[model samples]
Target chain A: MGKVAREVVEKAGINVDELVKKLVRAAGAEFTTYYYYTILRANAIGFDGEGIKEIIEDMRIEDRNHFEALVPRIYELGGELHRDIKDFCKDAACPDAYLPSNPRDVKALLQVLIEAERCAIRVYADICALTAGKDPRTYELSAAIMNEEIEHEAWCSEFLGEGPSGHFRRGAPGESPYVSRFLVVPKPGV
Target chain B: MERRWVTIADSSELAADGVKGFSVGDKRIVVVRYRGRYYAFDAACPHMAGPLDEGTIVEGRLECPWHHYLYDLESGENYYPKNVYPDDLKHTVAPLRKYPIRETEGKLWVALEDAKA
Candidate 1:
């Protein structure tokens, strides 16, 4: 742990340890969501499933990107991910987005996806609200991830034909316009 | 230990349809007022410990802000899953713990040990 890095947030009157716990849990949610989405993406098939499958794939990779982005900040704040993989899943901040019993029912599948994204939006919004102005880096990172989550919700809502979400689909697979910069991995084709 | 009365908040802090959070001896308790009655329950969500102080009371249920898991303010039972969730998931969402609360002398008092299931 960098003494100076840790003290900055502590001196700001924030409980660094609590904040780190929140970050770690948020990261755990992203990591687990990525895994569940993989199952959803695979089961999303056939005629009706084709369209939503693309969206699911996009969200899957972006959630993975979010996990990749959050880990470094967790360490920077003097926290570490659980060594046990099961513990990581158990520590997820949001409930798992289990695939519906009838994966063939596209509507049910979309509902599960939309609810997961909504939970993610609330999670990041709380973190953003807590760390705003006091911790710039975490705040900025959360805001970026929240942007994608909001878009994901919009996409699922639109696919369900709920109404116009006033957003377009991604230009390419894994087009993480907002959170890509925070990723430690180099951008594709860079 | 026997249950003891603990003063939690001034009456004025909780307006009708309002919620307030108070920490009592390491226990975080949230008080909610609805229909001119007050109810108290554990403030941390049974799901993820999301602060229930940040949650909203909807149709007599306290909705956790993190994932929107709701608990009936009166019964402290997980409210929506019975209708919104599948047959299996309804059994998985845990009910919140509730404490006995009363208002007297312009202050709110809660029974520390007698938590309703």
Candidate 2:
């Protein structure tokens, strides 16, 4: 717990407990999404699925980046992840991004991916709205994550034949354009 | 036992699937209008105390937004992960507390006492 850091947020008249709870859930969502996406990415085979593997990999690793970036801020705000792994997973803010019942149906898979990204966008947007002005550090971090989530949604949506994403590939896949600066561990390749 | 009923809102104010949270003294309560009927329960999820008011109601069950643990709106029974949850673990966590609600004269009221089986 950062004594001074906690004190500053408390003095700002924010409910530290509520804020911490939200942060923990957000982190849990990111972590669990990373795990689930890996499965989805691995199963990305066949005609349409193979074509989109690159995008799935990009989103998968970026979600992991988000989880890494969020932990330090959680501890800084005096929040601790549950010692029990079950508890941590059970508290994830978003629903599980379950693989489609028919894995071979590429459209079904895309639907799942698009919905998960949309949920993430909402989660970060809510955090950003709550922390704006009241807690600058969390606000900035959440805003950064929100930007990535938005881009991720666009990429998945474009694949669904919705509309053009207006985005080219990242300089490299899963570059963590907005959140990499906050990660303590060096990314494998930036 | 005597039941104390408190008026929480007018029936017209709640649309189908609408969820509202209220602070009755120190207790947080959530009321949901589902399938033309209203159900009331403790606002916090048993797992992590997630705000139940923010969760979605589907197929007669309300899901906790945090972990997606589900409870039947009427019976307050754990509807998901019961078969998967360890037997001892199931017994350890608290189940949702449901309060009886009545609609009369265009208003909805909740009894302070737990609903009788």
Candidate 3:
């Protein structure tokens, strides 16, 4: 069982065994999303330049660390890791909602990163809210994850240099003409 | 900065589920009517500059069609699909830039240029 989960169980006056199992499942979901984004970012680097490649690599390492961080908690909670990462990928919530059609396109990659960061921000925030005051240790860990996610989003946005409009324009070529057409309204007096 | 009040639309021009786009000099703005109130924001999305007027308003939040990023109309805060941050931090500083808005004579006016600080 993970040391932190054990502590939470011991301190929260709850059944240690049951809480550990719940945490294991929760961690499994988080690990799945982390793994999926890591793969997506890794693929994105090849289509982009060294700068993006470096960013992707750094993000991958961070995600892996998150997964590793959860393992101890899983074990301490007497839960097992979901062996197949693919299973988790199939139903990921945010970062996994959409994959870039071509990973080599820097713009596409940036768009994906922006979306992923946004998702991470909300998901981590929700997690922090869930654990707040209820489980101090978990709250601390989640809060940390939330901060990094925000940084990742800001980095991606700065790289894109354009907000939502720029993102859609860059990705427009990859999408069906119909989809692109639906994204804009005619400018007044244009 | 020059603040010229460009005529956006007649107050009654926007119906429920309706969004209109306008330009004041080089800036783009969107006027939306949802939940019986008129609201305005930067015409583009903060993430990738998605045209905000082209998106849909539901439950007081705007959902970008490009990636489904939802932003609260009132506070211009992204609601769903937020980024995750590390611990040891007190708060996340990421938020969309909000424009000042006023309703005069039933018409909504939004400052397209940065306000004087």
> How do the residues A107-184 of candidate 1 rate in per-residue lDDT, one tens digit apiece?
888888887887788789888988998988899999999999999999999988988789877888878999989989
Candidate 1 clashes between residue pairs 3 or more apart in a chain or in different chains: none
Ranking of all candidate structures by their TM-score, best first: 1, 2, 3
Selected candidate, larger lDDT, 2 vs 3: 2
What TM-score does candidate 1 reach?
0.84
How far off is residue B71 in model 1, in Å?
Answer: 3.2
Provide the DockQ value for model 2.
Answer: 0.20
CAPRI-style grade of the A/B interface in model 2 = incorrect
Q: By descending DockQ, how would the candidates be arranged?
A: 1, 2, 3
Clashing pairs in 2: none
Q: How much is B61 displaced in model 3, in angstroms?
A: 5.7
In terms of TM-score, the best-performing candidate is: 1
lDDT of 2 by residue, A60-137 (tens): 989989999999999999999989988888778776676766667777777778767866876777778778888999
lDDT of 3 by residue, A1-190 (tens): 4666567556766555544443443454456555655666556644355566555555554544554555555565566655686644433334242344554667766776666666566655655655566666556666665665666677678778754322222222122222122223332353
lDDT of 1 by residue, B10-82 (tens): 9899878988899998999988999989999889988878889878776778877655566888788886433
Interface root-mean-square deviation, candidate 1:
3.1
lDDT of each: 0.85, 0.82, 0.57
Q: How many residue pairs clash in each candidate at the backbone level?
A: 0, 0, 42
